[model samples]
Target chain A: MAADLAHLSPLLIVCCVGLGILLLDVFADPKQPKTFIGYVAVVGLLVALAATGWLFATGGVLLTQPYFAVALTLDPFALFGFALILVVAILTTLASVHYLPSQRCEWGEYYSLVVFASLGMMVMVAAADLITMFVGLEIMSVAIYVLAGFKRQSPFAIEAAMKYFFLGAFATGFLLYGLAFVYGATGSTNLNVVAEHFAKNDPGLYGIVIVIMMIVAFGFKIAAVPFHMWTPDVYEGSPSPIAGLMAGGVKTAAFLALARVFLTAFGGADFENLAISWREVFYWLAILTMTVGNILAVVQQNVKRMLAYSSISHAGYILIGIVASRSVDGGAVAGSGLFFYLLAYALSSVGAFAVVSMLGKDGEEDITYGNLAGFAYRHGFAALCMVIFMASLAGIPPTAGFLGKYLVFTDALAATHMNLLPLVLVAVVNSMIGVYYYLKVIVFMYMREPRREFETIRSVPMGIAFGLAALVVVVCGSFPDTTIRWSAKAATGNPSADSAISAASVIDVPAPVATTAK
Target chain B: MEQVIFWILAIGTVASSVAVIVPPMGRNPVHGALSLVVAFFFLAGLYVMLVAHLVAVLQVLIYAGAIVVLFLFVIMLLNIQSEDLGHPRPTISKLIGVIAVGFVSIVLIGFILKDKGMAEPPVGLPSDSTFGTVKTVGNLLYTSYIVPFELTSILLLVAVIGAVIMAKRRL
Candidate 1:
């Protein structure tokens, strides 16, 4: 019992911060700014992140407890996700500190709501039961829907909220349907039980429907094509920092949940026959999402919308890593490249959006090229920070994003199970196309003259936010070894990944089938 | 006796459910909602036959007691006349939707034919007597599912707080 509670400390800590902020808000002066609440949120997340790292270091989730739990998994895989989500939430709070007051929506509830959303995300990544995952996902989405429209006076913000709520509810419906179908097939909602059932018995047609429904629901969250119609509008309409949170924190949480469910319940040695079809589905999905995302992004003049599409394309790159990491063909593949790329991509997108949010003056977003012109001349350091983020996003060297792309593509090439070569080639071309638009921002910032007079918010906190993100981007890119090894260790949440990682390590590998049953 | 009662309740459920969408009951929203309540009670009775007492009670309390009343309230608040409703039209999209549904049905039928074991739906098999008891369900909530149950309260808080934040006139 004590060990179980120890596993729960990160979530408990964040939930306390959320409620504590709400309680403290009662005493704060309404006439005063609420950035203090934001500071508290940051400090709380820091403590939680530190606790997560400490847990991972000291033999994970409660050294006394067994490797698995019934409702939540506090394994290294989940701990890695927790660290990334906490980082993004902390950055989001820092970015919103100045933006909220500038827009005159600096209510204490905003800070509490963001903290609760992170709490929700922590639950999602740590879910061991399908039901737990669904509930956690709902908590995260509901909080974000509120944050998306935090600017209540703006019609665009309200529209963003309603649109996201409707579509998110529909996606959730798909997930629920999938859940019911899986239960009907296996007579269990537990991930380990579902995996054992699928391993022993052929899932047949019901499995196909379940897989497709899960894909559609998760696809919407990660902004994959055919389910990505909502991304551009919602991103454009949302408060800029909240939009960054959507692109960063929410997307990371969803992807982690998706990987956990699919890799655990659906991937293994015994279920290879079932895995092939979904892998093929993802291969085509990866191609379409990247090609379509890149081509459409090139024509968008609004920086926010363009970044939304670029995030979609980046999702495709990460999907390639998932495809490669999924199969177990007794190959030397050490990791999925998922954790490292996710960390890199989350930081870059949040950093980029933080810069773009600065361009919003007087609560109105003017992020077009015309508005961006002469940004370098006005603010040299901010422009430089923006350039580092953009270059990283475009997968240039000396940044985390480049190494992130390198690891994922190499994983795809190294996989012996399926021919992922074509997918990697398409990603190569797509990233090339991606570079053109990523540079367009740079061109406008340094070269073009300002078409009309415009002023940007140069708040100290926003600078700190992007500056910290940029620093991480550069450092992670240069010193990629530790992150690589840590993420590879993190990839061992599923039995197949356990086998894969163990195959490369000097230690004797455990029997994959023995653990597959539990 | 149980079989006879099951048959009666099943017939009542189907009949009232059909009444909700056709003829005189359908013409009036109030009447349709009333029929829906009747259908809900019949369903609850069927659930009771399966030994799912908690589900039967929830079917009555949530569907008949709460949801049906909410429906009646909405109908009354809107005061929409039946004459205000448009006649059903068969549009191109509707035609395509029908075709798509038919195609899926055909595919499912083929799958059922190929897989003989899955062709028949499982009917009222015996379940544990205590499986759906209120006490057992409550135990499950506080024991095995304590984490998810607590988390859902946080979810409700987000929804409630969000509704207030969005609905309130000012921050």
Candidate 2:
């Protein structure tokens, strides 16, 4: 019981903070009095971070025996996801401190929603059952839909909300249908049970269909091509802070959940019995998502819109990691690479959006490339940070983005050795294409001169947070080993660890001895 | 007798679904709402076939009865005309929609053609036991899925508050 409490502490803290903020809003004046809701949120997230660290430090002590039985597993992987979520939450809260007031929509619900959404994300990454995962997905998505359209009066905000809602609903339907099919096939929604079914049965067409449906659902979540139409409009219309959260927090959680589902539940020899291989699907998706996202980003004039497309491109890169992990012998390396890249992408993108959030004045800042002329001269510190973020995003040397790309490429190369050479080539080319837009942001920031007087709102706390994020981006870039090692460990599900199912249960059953006597 | 009812409900569902999507030239919102009602009723019938009689009843009560009424009220209050259907969709969007539906059809047909072995129903399960009926569902909802079940209620409350807040002239 105590162990359960310890595992749940971070989520509990977030919920309490959300409720506290809601209560505080009742007494506080509506006229934004430099309210400390953002600070409170950041503090709450920091506490969650500390709790995660403590949990990790104690190792197996706080790792409760699957908290909700067949539903949730409070394991090291979940802890790792919780830590990532907390970091994103902290950065988003800090960004929101300055960003919200400028937009004239400084409501307490913003903080509450952020906290609640983070809690949902934590739940999503930790979910061991399909139903639990769905609940978490809905909780996170519902909050995000509201956040996306928080500025009710704006037509763009309304449109963004409508687009997100419509597409999100459609995606949910696909996901639910997929779940139904999986249930129909295996008569169980438990991951381990499904894995066991795969091991025991020759999954013919039904298994392939179910897997395809699941891929479609996850494809929408990760913003892969053909299913990625909503990304730009939503990101462009949303408040920059919320956009940062969507890009960083939401994407990271989704990727982690996707990795967990695919790698742990649906990979290895058992999966070979299924008529269709997921590797081929992922190979195509990775190539298309990366190539298309990068190409689309290149044409975008709006900085936010460009970043949104850049995010799509990054999703493609992460898909490469997923594809690699599904290959014969590249699971561990690719999985680790995926997590590291997710961390790098989240930090860089969040920081970039933080700078973008700062650039706005009075809710309507047209952040076109031309508008950012001479930004370096006007906002030196912000411009420098933006440069760092851009460099990281462009995968330049000594940046976290570069290390992330390095790991991903290495994994891709390894997978290529196992007959995935075409995918590797496509990914390599896409990475080159990705550099153009990321560098374009830099060129706009440094080379161009400010055309008009760029009025800046100086929030000390926001500035400090941005500085810290920039520092992490650099530090992680230079010293990538620690994060890489941890991610590797996290990705390799501890089959020997105390859980309902043991590693032996996962091993392939050797073909029954040939009955020569027959 | 049960198979006959299944076919009837399935046909109704398909017809209503078609009606919901297809209304030419500035159809009234109430028409759309009514079509949704038909769809919900058919879905309830489906629930009945699945032995989830309680869920079917609730589906009709909540979705068809209450929700459709709410939709009608909103449409009346908004006084949205057919011409107010906002902007017309672009040709490209329509083309994309057609392509998407085509793709879905192709995939569905492919699966149907694949001839995967049909699942065998669990044997010895009593037909009259109400295993998937309302009582069992409610029991499971209250016990196992209690958190989300309660959370859904809270979500509805928040949605109510939000709607009132958004629509009210003065808060």
Separate clash counts for every candidate: 0, 5
The prediction achieving the highest DockQ against the true structure is 1
Highest lDDT: give the candidate number.
1
Model 2 lDDT per residue over A1-518, tens place: 57677667876787677677767876777775545877877887888889887766554232333324455655556777888888888888888887777777676777777777787788778766677777777778877887887766667877887899889989999888878866766665656556656566655555666677788888888898878989999999988878888999999888878876776567657565555577677778888898899999999999999999999989988888888775223124235788788888998888888888887778775788888888888888988888888888888879899888888878767764246567767877877887888777778778887788887667776677677778989999998888887777666644323443532232222332211110
Native-to-model Cα distance after best TM-score fit, residue A449 in candidate 2, in Å: 2.2
Model 1 regions lying over 4 Å from their true place: A62-68, A327-334, A493-518, B1-46, B63-115, B118-128
Candidate 1 residue pairs in clash (backbone atoms < 3 Å):
none
lDDT of 1: 0.82
Q: What lDDT does the true structure give each of the candidates?
A: 0.82, 0.75
**TM-score of every candidate:** 0.88, 0.91
- CAPRI tier for the interface of model 1: acceptable
Q: Which residue pairs collide, candidate 2?
A: A373-A449, A373-A450, A374-A448, A374-A449, A374-A450
